[model samples]
Each structure stands twice: as C-alpha cells, then as structure tokens.
Target: MRIAPALLAAATLLAGCATTPMARTAGPANVPPGMQYLYGSGEAAALSEQAYNALVDSVRAQLAKGRPATAAILLPAANGTSAPGTCGDKPYAAVFDMDETAVLNLGYEYNDAQTGATYDTARWSRWEASGAEKVAAVPGARRAFVALRAMGVTPIINTNRNAAGAVPTARALAFAGLGDFKHQETLFLKGDADGKSAKDGRRAAIAARWCVLALGGDQLGDFTDALGTTPAARRRSVSSSAYADWWGRRWFVLPNPVYGTGLGSGWDDTFPASTRWTDPGDAASVAQPK
Candidate 1:
C-alpha cells in the first residue's frame, strides 16, 4: 500500500481541515475526523455489513445461474484490450483485500494517532509482523466468510502486505476470526506475483485457478490497476458504463476513510465550480441575530 506523492500532498492539505487551533489544544481529540469515522463510528460498521451482505447475495445469485463463462477479474491483454478471465470448470472463489477491508489495524492506527506521523514503510512492516493480536475483523466479514464457505465458495485474500510477513498476516486474519489463510494458496501478498504493489498480476494468478465470483477491497487497485491515478480520473473510470453496474453486482468496496488512494482530492476535484455558492451577507451581521 504505497501512497503516491499526489495522495500524500492531498492528505497534507486535508490534514489542515482536520487540525484546528481548538483541536490542537484538545489533546486526545487530535485524532483526525476520517480516523474517528472509520475506526469508531457505527455508520462505518453498518456500511461494511451492507457491503458484505450485498456481496453474499450477488454470489448466491451468480451461483444459481450455474457456472459462469468468465471470472469477475479484469484481465489485461497485450493487444490493448481487456476482458474478464475465462472460466473453465474452476472452483468458485471470492478475492478480498485484507487490511481495512477484512480487518482493522487498531493497534497501528492508535500509535499513528498518538505520534501524528504519516505512513512509514518500516513501521508498517513491523506492524505486519507483530500486530496480529491487535487486529479486528471488519464488521460482517466473519459472517460473510461462513456464508461463502457454506455456499461452496472459497474466500481468498489478495493483499499488498509483504510476503515476508505471511505468517503473521495469516495470524492476523485468523485472530480477527476470518479463518486461516495459507500463503500463496489462500493468501497472496505483494511479492507473490511480479513483485509489485498493483494487484492485477496477483488477481490474474488467482483467476487462472478459480472462478472469481466477487471482489472486495477498500481501494480500486484491489479489483484492477486500470483505474487512472487522479481523483477525477478514478471517479470517471468507476462510473464508466463498462464498470458502472459492477459496484454491487460483482465488486464490493468497504469504507476506508482513514487512509488510502481515495483520500487525496483537492477542492476543485471535490466540488464543481457550477455548484459554488456565496453567503451574500456580512458575517458579523448574520451572527448578530441568526
């Protein structure tokens, strides 16, 4: 999960909105609003539950239609075209991103909040190796796993967590009650395929063996690397007709406001100029009576 420079810049800008003079004086209140909403709010929990429920339903419906002709994964072709992986009697499986999608790294996040530091690769590597006990399964993930297994669908984790920490990563998933994830078999990591952070290669490897019915993650890269880098490009890519209907049908995204590629958007990218509005009154006069 390497944060791009653009995303880092956006995060720094957005941090200003979260940290105010009053917030800085409040001590423990220094936790960013995004972190609070993602890690502490019930709304995020409900959203996770809703996404999992939809995913399960989608899988069930697809299974009812018998074997699929193509996998849910988008495969890039050398001829400048892309298509879903062809399915040929492969076992049914659902691919999911682990961190923030399947489990919450409560311990690492707490430390981060306490220190007010940006993402640190070395620190994250340490957490990956030692933070198993501090993780919790995302809401509804446990139940979703049970339901998927009961329906004869295997749950597979494809995360950007390093392969060197495979043992502890599996432990973290199990600790969070998500069941066992064996390296290279049930769990695929960053160095597992092509040694890149992008997951499309790993996804291709998984799709080659299993008929992927559903894809779940907090970042767009979990599903495909074709999404453009910018905020506007990413939004348009998802909303395009080719993928517009895939949201709740074959792809499920869990909420992750704390951090990710989705966090960095400027004011112009977030709000359209046509929608801008002016108060049309003095602040002192408005505050005098209203």
Candidate 2:
C-alpha cells in the first residue's frame, strides 16, 4: 500500500523516540546498590558541610585560649597513646578522611548509574587513569580544610585511595581552593597505617605530634577504631564511653548511603536478580518458631 508522505514522516519520528532508553521509573527499588552517587548527591553534600562546620568550630574553640582540652585523635599510637599536638607554637589540628569522607568518589558510582552500567576493574582503571581530572571536592569540605588551616590548625587528608590518586586528588583540592597543608607526609593511604586495626596508631601519631582538635569522615572508623566486627558492634562502638565523649562533640560525620561496610548481608552472597536485591521474607519464613 502506498503511504502518505506526512504519515511516513510521523512514523520515523515516533520510531526514534521509541528506541531511546526509558526514563528510569521509581519502584520498590528506584536505585541500585552501586549507584549511590546518582541517588544521594544531596545527602553527600549535606554531610560535607556538617564535617566542615564541625572542624571549624572545633579548631576555633580549641585555639581560643589556655590549652587544648577537647581533641579528636585521628589515630592512636602503637602503644595505644595519642601523640600530643604541638609545633613550636601552633596548638590544635583537624584530620580529614578522603573518599566519601572528604571528596566524593561519586564519579565511579555516578557514571555507572547514568550509563546504566556496572563496575569492573577495567572501568575503574580508566576512571583512575583519566587522572580523575573532573573530580571535585566534597561540597564544602575543601573550604572547611582551608578554614581550619586559616585558624592555625593542621588539616590532614587521610585517604584509602592509592598513590595514583595523589596528584589528581591534590590538584582537585587545590582547584577547589583548599590551601596548601604542609607536612607533606600526612596523607595516609592503606599501607601507610601501622599495625593497629583502629586508627589508634595513626591518631596517636597525629596526637603525639599535632593537636587534633577535631576529626571528620563518613564512616565511624575515621573517627575511632571502636566500630567493631558486626554492624551491632559498630553501633556499640559509637556509643562506647571513650567515643561517647567525642561523638558529635569533637567529630562530625557526613552521610554515605552509597558504599560502606555498613550494609548488612542480604541476597548478595547468592544469585540475585539485580545488584541491589535484598532478600524478601524468604529467610524469616524458614526460621523455626521460638
């Protein structure tokens, strides 16, 4: 059959639109596990501000007068003691955690979601090899770092990111206007930490040398090693006496709903329909009645 010219044109246009990927719809699961950046950008930004303000207030309060009273040690020493913070004349400090703690590794998760893709070493290497040139500071985080520096407090960025990230990370921080924090040796990566599983060793080291007035990060581990084996342990650690004093007082934590060890095991250990799948009432159904 012969088609009308306008009808043919309309069919072509409709076909093009039909082939396009659908706008992701909301469901019981709107976002997947690895797509926190795509799902939680606002939360991450809010957390960054919280950490920044905590450091600023802690530093200002510490250096106000007589002596450093309240301080959050980044790592405790090997012997379980904190290094005192003193430098000829300078008083206290504030230590920061990189990754979600300081700058959002949002790209890894963000790209995955936007492109409807998954993570792989090859992809991550490309992400890193690109020098993370597009990386940005955790919202207000860099400003907080600079502010602490301005207050005469040492600002240290401790990260788990490998050395390959050093140059790019530094540049990004600089571009974000975070002034230079001397003592070149302080950016801590995984291998740099001592035997202590807890940051005690590092915190102690910093405490021994620098008066850490406050500490900020997304995870509890950044503040103290008290966060234990299980999720419950971690919860307990946060409420424990030693950390009780520091919680929210000398430490500020940013939100990290994307990735962390915090999420309890779900259907993840077995075959699941999707990356973000969670076990339904299946487990409870199998449990014996008490």
Candidate 3:
C-alpha cells in the first residue's frame, strides 16, 4: 500500500487490538520490518522468473507441432466455458497484468515503505506517469515476451491502471526491454469502457477478438473473480470444486504480499473451534498470556 508523502508525515499510528500470543510459537509476534518487501524483491522475483520461463517453454512446445494448447488460463476453473476459438483467424494471444506481473514496482513500494506513505491515486499516478526510468521488468519477463512474438502469439497487456496511465505504462515496459507490444489495441487500460474495475468484461472483449492462451498475474482477480471478496470467499473461489483443478497448467500466479485484498479486508470475526487443529498434548500445559 502507498499514500501521499504529506499524509504519511501527518498520519498518526493507530493502536491495534491487543491479543494474547499463542503458546509454542517459534517466531516473533510481529513481522520483522522490511521482511515483506524483501520477499517481493528477492524470493518472489526468482520464482516468477522460473514460472515465466516454464510458460514460454510450454507455449513453444505446443506451437511447434502446429497445435494450439487446449488450455485456457483465462477461463474460470469451475465453469463450462473454454478458451474462445480463434476469432476468424484473428490471432493467438497471451494476456498479462502490468504491475507486479510484467513490471516490478519494487522501487515504488520500497520508497513508500521507507517514507511511511499510503497508497493514494494521486501518488500512484505520479509514480506511473514519471517513475518509469526507475521501474524494471520482472526477471525472465523480457525473454518470455520476446518468445511469445516468435511463437506467433500476440502479446496483450491488460492493466487496472486508469487510461491516463497508458503512455507512461508503455514507456516503462519499453524502458525495461519488454516493449514489443507497440499497438494501441495491445494495451488495455482500466476503465476503457464502463468504469467498473473488474477485468472480466475487458478480458471477454479480448477473448472475443483473439484466442487467449494464457493468463498470468500476482492477484487471483488476474485469472478469475477473486478480487474485492472477503478472505474466506477468495479462498473458496480458488479451492472450491468449480475452480480447483487448473492451478499450474492453466493459471500462473505470482506472489505479491505488499497490497492485496488482505490489506483491506478487516479481520474475520467468526471462529469455530471444530475447524481448528487438536494437538495430542493437554491444552492446560500451554501458557496463555492474560
């Protein structure tokens, strides 16, 4: 999450609800400072790099045999829908999210954390508009992007950033060496039509014009209707019988802990002891702080 510098400077730290720590825990009560950023900067990058490379390899193999992959990453795991047939030989395309998936906004995130800023539209707009020279591509993203073109798959960029962000967004992608998508239609910005943030409509529009082979992003919404839902509801979307099967083969997910639904979804109040684990040891043995 990010906010304006002024807001950051004036914001007061709020007190969180006090809770007793669980007994037998192996680590500290609070997350160590900067740990989340470190994961996004280091470990997550490496994993994403591998995933992109694997996707390229898989796509290449399928294309080599003059056969398009039957998988549809954009389709919901629970539905009867399938990848749209090529729209009258329109084209085979691959879709990706811009931030955190195609481009690494680590610099923005780090600066926000260091300066104690919160995520606001103005701040984010400034970052997108002029922060390009600072942004970088996700590892392996450039190579995979290049390969997509070679495989005869048109690369389409779909981002939730508003329409005003199109130019800078393109600049950043190009600056990072992943700028093959030069055409206007290739880049789909948020609010292209009716102003709902849900990407399903835009994705449908793209699918109507092309055969969408794969979809990749850091959030569940990148692939399905998992955005803006409660934590449990989001979990159910991915785990339920309708959508549980196409994890690695169709949908490719990258890790982003910085600012997802959990950052805004308030703590869940319901608790059912029956759903929790039961250890063999006596419950009385563990000390509970008052």
Candidate 4:
C-alpha cells in the first residue's frame, strides 16, 4: 500500500506538539529579510527590458491607430504603469511605477542575497543617496522611453515607494541611461497628499490634463480593483476584455516573486514542505541548525 511518509510524519509531530515547519509560528524577529531581489539580476533586468519594449510599442501602435484612450498595469508584482500623465499640452503620457519598475535596487539586492542577508536601511539609503550609482537601465527600456518621448508621449513615475524616494529614483533613472522624465507631481506615491492607493483615481487626476493611452506594470492592482481580493473577481476582470491575451502583449509583466502580495498573505506566510517536495519525518529532528 502506498503511504505518504509526510502524512504519517505530520500526524506523529502534531500528536506530540506543533513541530511542523508550517506550524512553527513566527515571532517579532522572524520578519524575514524579505524577497528584495526583484532587481539587479542580469536575467531579471533583461526581462524587464523586453517587457518595457513590448509595452511601449503596444502604446505607440494603439495611439498611432487611435484606439483606447488609456491602458493600465496591475500590481501584486511591481507597481503597474499607465499612459503618461500630462504637464501642459502634452496629451500623450505614460505612467510607470517607481521602485522596482523604473529603477531597481540591484546592488543592495544582489549583495544581500549573495550573503544570505536582509535589506539594511542604512545600505539602501547609501545606495540611493547618489543619483550616480551604477545602474544599468532595463533592456530596451531606454530606447522605448526615448521612442515614447519622440512620439510626444510623457512618462510619469507612479509608485508606492514614498515621495521622498523620488529624487534618488530620478537620479537612478538617469544613471541607468533611461534619462529623466519628470518628478514631484509626476511621481505619485501611496500616501502623498493623495491619501489613496486607488491608482484609478490617480489616473483620473492625470487624465484630467493629458489623455493616457496605455498602462503597464507587474501587478493587477495597477489596473483597477473595483472588486475585492476574491480570486474570481480578478479572473473575471482581466478575462472579460480583449486584454486577456494582452498580458505579455500590452501589459508587460516583469517576473517578481519577491516582495509584493505573491508572498503569503502576511509576513508569517511560508511554504510547507508538503507544499511541493515530499514531507519529511521529524522536521524538527532534521531542522537542527548546522
């Protein structure tokens, strides 16, 4: 008879005490280093570039053909992007999320991961203190941004990384060779006087001036979340429109398993051994620190 060893093991462990890794509760100190590696990896950056190019092109084509007025990028990955916000008569504008979307914390992420470390605020500040840090623009991003600018489309940085981050973020953009677009009012934040995470409102504010033509980002919330967190709600929204196939087409999503809602529901969420590989026996017995 085929018996799952993990089932027996879980039964044995729970019988005695909550010793399963999944059951091991976290304390104040277990807040994790956090998955801060969304940026800096060569492969990830390359993918970001590819996504950027595809997105800008999609916007160009749509605008050139006079289709949708605005597009949106969603969240749960990096923040999303949208058609730009306007300044003056510039009706063509693009909205891109800050943080990992435009500029990445690559140096910090790479160094920390290489050492099995966590995100150090001091290091982060130091890295972002200068606008001259060696940051390579995501692949194809420079050309895309430049192309959009040539098309008279304005690009704005909309992010959740706080307005204070706007300066360094701007610097990083220039350092990456992505050139500087606009900051301040152009950089929308989570709690900046706006008092909202509802990007749709933010988009409306932008549209009040310029006509946004498209949007892109790594998450769904970047688009719109009229519905709550119900999975069915999200599926119906994206699947209902022609935008279903628009995932990699117009909505360029760079892979980001780190941070964002993709992680468990909270800081305490973790993977159970049973989640994938065969469950082990006396994980506590095997979990002894080396």
Candidate closest to the true structure, highest TM-score? 1
Give residue 286's lDDT in candidate 1 (0 to 100): 65
> Which predicted model would earn the best lDDT?
1
lDDT of each: 0.85, 0.56, 0.64, 0.54
TM-score of 3: 0.75
For candidate 1, the TM-score is: 0.90
- Tell me the tens digit of each residue's lDDT in model 3 across 1-290: 12122222111111223323223333335432333543445676688887787777766765666655353545343466533334445578888888878887766765664544456787888888888888778777888898899878877887887688788888888888987454348888777644657777777777767777777777777776643267667766677655676566556776554555433333352334556554547565344332
lDDT of 1 at 132: 94
Clashes of each: 0, 18, 6, 19
**Candidate 2 lDDT, 1-290, residue by residue in tens:** 00011121122232232122234442212334323342355654665676677668766766776566435663434686533334344455677776656665555555544454434546655765564545567778767776876776667776544455566656655654665533335565443547433455666566656667777877677776656766656766677765676766677877654445544423433234675534456687557453
Instruction: Please provide, for model 4 over 181-227, each residue's C-alpha lDDT reduced to its tens digit, 9 standing for 90 to 100.
Output: 55545666555545676566665666566656555565565645443
Report each candidate's C-alpha RMSD, comma-separated, in the order given: 4.0, 12.8, 7.4, 11.6
Q: State model 4's lDDT.
A: 0.54
Off by over 4 Å in 4: 1-46, 67-90, 114-134, 227-237, 240-250, 265-290
lDDT of 1 at 26: 39
Tell me how far the alpha carbon of residue 247 in candidate 2 is from the true structure, in angstroms, after superposition.
1.4
1 versus 2: better lDDT goes to: 1
Query: 33-139, model 1: which lDDT tens digit per residue?
Result: 66777788999999999999999999999989989898899998788867889889999999999988999989987776665556768888899988999989999
Cα misplacement distance, residue 206 of candidate 2 (Å): 2.6
The window of 10 residues in a row where model 3 has the poorest summed lDDT is 6-15
Model 4 TM-score relative to the real fold: 0.61
